[model samples]
Target: MREWHADYLDACNRHDLDAIRSFLSPSVRRAHLPSGSDAWIDDLAELFTAFPDWRWRRVQLIAEEDRLAVHLRAGGTHAAAFRGIAPTRRHVNVAEFAMYRVMDRRIAEYSGTGDHIELLAQLHGGLPT
Candidate 1:
């Protein structure tokens, strides 16, 4: 699981959509991505566009049977619009948490959350007064 997940992260870091897709099941269930793997991939593409240098590093990982949990730290520079916020050219680092269920050596299901509030705050010059 560790090696597989590391390779998955490497694909993401490389922005290789095809490589990332190879790690997912055909019917993958992504809790945060309602439209399925395609949507999730599209979202990742959008993020890469917004943060051209985006990168994620695993901070923690736990594996049990067919399940795996991960904590990641993501950092990047804001180079384009994101969630309607114009580019601020700010650098942001945020935490992300995810849990995955692997089936047949591929990710069958997963759910995750990120520190979006902190990201927005950083992009917006430390939130509203």
Candidate 2:
């Protein structure tokens, strides 16, 4: 289970498109979207590109049945544009949570939330988005 969690974060931090693609199940769904995007793999890849140095830390995992809920804090220096904001070089930390449904011990769908508001606040100096 830890190995699975580590691989996901490693792919995220490295922004490795191949790793992301190879790891995803064809039916991957992201429940965070109102219309549950089926393009989770691509969306994840884009997010990492937008925040190239983005990294996850202090991860916690809970397992039940064929699913896992992951909690982690992500932080990085804002060296690139994100959420329509230009570079701020601001160090920001945000909480992240994801629930993954596994099929045959392979990830099938993921629902996630990230605190982008705090990152925007840090960049905009008191502005919250």
- The candidate that wins on lDDT is 1
Please, what are the lDDT tens digits per residue for candidate 1 over residues 1-129? 999899999999999999998888878887756646787787788889999999999999999999999999998999999989999888888888999999988888988884267778878888431
Error of 2 at 1 (Å): 2.4
**What TM-score, computed on C-alpha atoms, does each candidate reach?**
0.90, 0.78
The Cα error of candidate 1 at residue 1, in Å, is 0.4
lDDT of each: 0.86, 0.69
Q: Candidate 2, which segments miss by more than 4 Å at Cα?
A: 34-38, 127-129
Q: Model 1 off-target regions past 4 Å?
A: 127-129
* Full-model lDDT, candidate 1: 0.86
Tell how far residue 51 is off in model 2, in angstroms: 2.4
